[model samples]
Target: MDLATDLELDHLVGRARRLVVPGRRRILGIVGPPGAGKSTLAGALVARLDGEAVLVPMDGFHLAGAELRRLGRAERKGAPDTFDAAGYAALLGRLRSPEPGTVVYAPDFDRSLEEAVAGSIAIDPSVPLVVTEGNYLLHDEGAWQQVRDLLDEVWYLHIDDDERVARLIERHVRHGKARPHAERWVRESDEVNARLVATTRRRADLVITGALTG
Candidate 1:
């Protein structure tokens, strides 16, 4: 890890350690625009926590590609309406209340297939924290509001516009979109969603501006 990432991990670990109780689960939500490194930060934090935390990403709640196509939303797949916001909120609620010896399974997003795989993540009841990273955790409208309510704390990752856009384009290309198509998707679809997410930044408990260099 780079110095910046080390510092960030230290800060997050300090804050998260305080939330730990002997028998209760603490939920941490990391929210940011596409390509802002929410998942990178969350993964680092969870690894540092050393098995005490489990990751349950909100990407798992994305509507299936088939479903998106059926609803005529495939072109704008990352929009707020393309997710099962209510189901995501409900899962957060479940993660917050764990029964002894019961393992909770959460869906996982498979980027290669562009689909959500059910029961892909297992959260054992012994885990004390759940680190969930996503683009819309702080979105206020509809069932998304409940998602904000279910978390113990929410951190918003912020990145420079140029860097974020570049990362988004690269990510799209890596995920099978050609260079020209990736550029268009970032400019047309991703930027629109990014602007919407920016509007909700004020609601975050912390604004994280660290870049993931490692």
Candidate 2:
């Protein structure tokens, strides 16, 4: 779907609703660059759905802050390799073929603490749908492709470039970065990653745009 003028986000969310089999779970993934409003959309969809749904963010797979610092990748924390991509893929594979009476625990990222906390969440097979969101979910190369295959369907959220950059800068400031530093980071680092993600847009099963209320 061409998010710009084709199908609306609500339509996609409704489709996801149908994938929920009463006894089994479905995994739906949302992929987009920073400030694309993916988190907001995911939250809204989960809220709209009447059944059980969980948001298992891929951010949870991020390497610990200390580990990133140790590897000299602290400055590029959101880059693909900074996360435990392979481990996340494994989790999704397990989620796909869950065992009876077994519960799966997953890690979650703590923004305030800037670290990944293990066993932060439990996924019960009865939940029906697990909605995971991240920047690299649709990426074609490396273990990212495994992520795409694992998801029953993938949605790419698209937003205007100007608005996206503005939102990213605001996010940095809200997270304690100085204005100039935030702008520089958005231009130099975030935008670079955004371009890489743009190339993967074609991989999405659907695309969403505008605000959640729009």
Candidate 3:
């Protein structure tokens, strides 16, 4: 079900709404390769749902740049090993079980700094739904398996390869990378992660395709 039209968005919203209950929290995951518009779709869902939902991105669990550097994984920054997958899963578990009068704080990714900012997002117990998007939510290996198990539903986004690659390069350049560097990173690093994520598409509850424009 592609979220390219208002009717499709309505269907997506309706599905998310059905998961909400009076006293429990439900999580919906948006999984896709980089530049596939996962974040954009997640944001649109949250906006359409208003206060009923909040966004908690998995990018927040990314390992600090220093840590990546120490581990010699700086060049492969988007790989599975570069994130705190266990921590993300634990947070999802907590979010799934809401305690009255308690607020859960989640981390957010600071793209400019290339690091995670702890306690940057507060998920109030009143928020019945959580929309978390990332590249690895549907992945089946290691701690990522736990992440897949924790989500109530996951949707995978698919986009044309040429368009996805073009968007990736533009994104990197907008975020301060030189054009040459952005192209190289997309080809060498992001593409590797994208291929890994593509293998997980069959596991998603729904597959979204089409041009995603925001």
Candidate 4:
């Protein structure tokens, strides 16, 4: 089956028109550059599902702000090394086992503090689908490689280059950056990260355009 075609949907819904049940322990990975609306699509997917679906964002694995600062990488916060990829891969591997009645705990990002809080969520094994999104899920390097193997499917969301930049600047501002500073960061920081993310696009099982199927 062509995954790209499966991602198309009615524009208003912002969801995939169909859900393919390839097998049990099905994990859907949404990979896209920053500001591509990956999280928005993940939320919509969870809302649209009848039952047995949950969101497990890769952002939860981000290294603590203090850790980034300690490593002198605060300015590169969104870079691949700024996340605990090994830990994330391990968790995904465990979740793929699908142990009935067992619960799996996962970390979550605290946007307010810009840090990762451990054990922010508990995934009940009864959930049949986990909608996970992140920039580096398809990165074929070290621990990131394991992420792809764990996922049952992966989708890459795409948006216009100009629009992505616009959204990134807006996001940075809403997240506390000053206007001019936000624009600078989007161009220098976010776009650099976006370039790295683009390399993983071809690895996606599906490629979606616009907000209609993020």
Residue 168, candidate 4: Cα error in Å is: 1.0
lDDT of 1 by residue, 1-214 (tens): 1112232667777787777776889999989899898888888888888888999999999999889999999999989999999999988988899989889999999989989999999999999999999999989998888888899988888888999999999998999999999999999999999999999888888887757543
Model 3 Cα shift for residue 27 (angstroms):
0.5
Kindly list the per-residue Cα lDDT of model 4 for residues 24-133, writing each as its tens digit.
66788889999998888887877777565778899999988788889999888888999999999999988888687789988888877777888887888777778888
Candidate 2, residue 42: Cα displacement in angstroms equals: 0.8
TM-score of each: 0.94, 0.92, 0.94, 0.89
Q: Residues 51-70, candidate 3, lDDT per residue (tens digit)?
A: 89999999999999999999
| Candidate 3, superposed: residue stretches over 4 Å from native | 1-7
Off by over 4 Å in 1: 1-7
User: lDDT (0-100) at residue 33 of candidate 1?
Assistant: 96
Off by over 4 Å in 4: 1-23
Clashing pairs in 3: none
Alpha carbon lDDT at 7, candidate 2:
33
* Residue pair clashes in candidate 1: none
Query: What tens-digit string does per-residue lDDT give for candidate 2 at 1-214?
Result: 5444333557766787987787887899988898898888887777777657888899899998889999998888888888888999999998888888889999988877878899998988778899899999988777877888889888888888999899999998988899999999998888988988888888888777665553
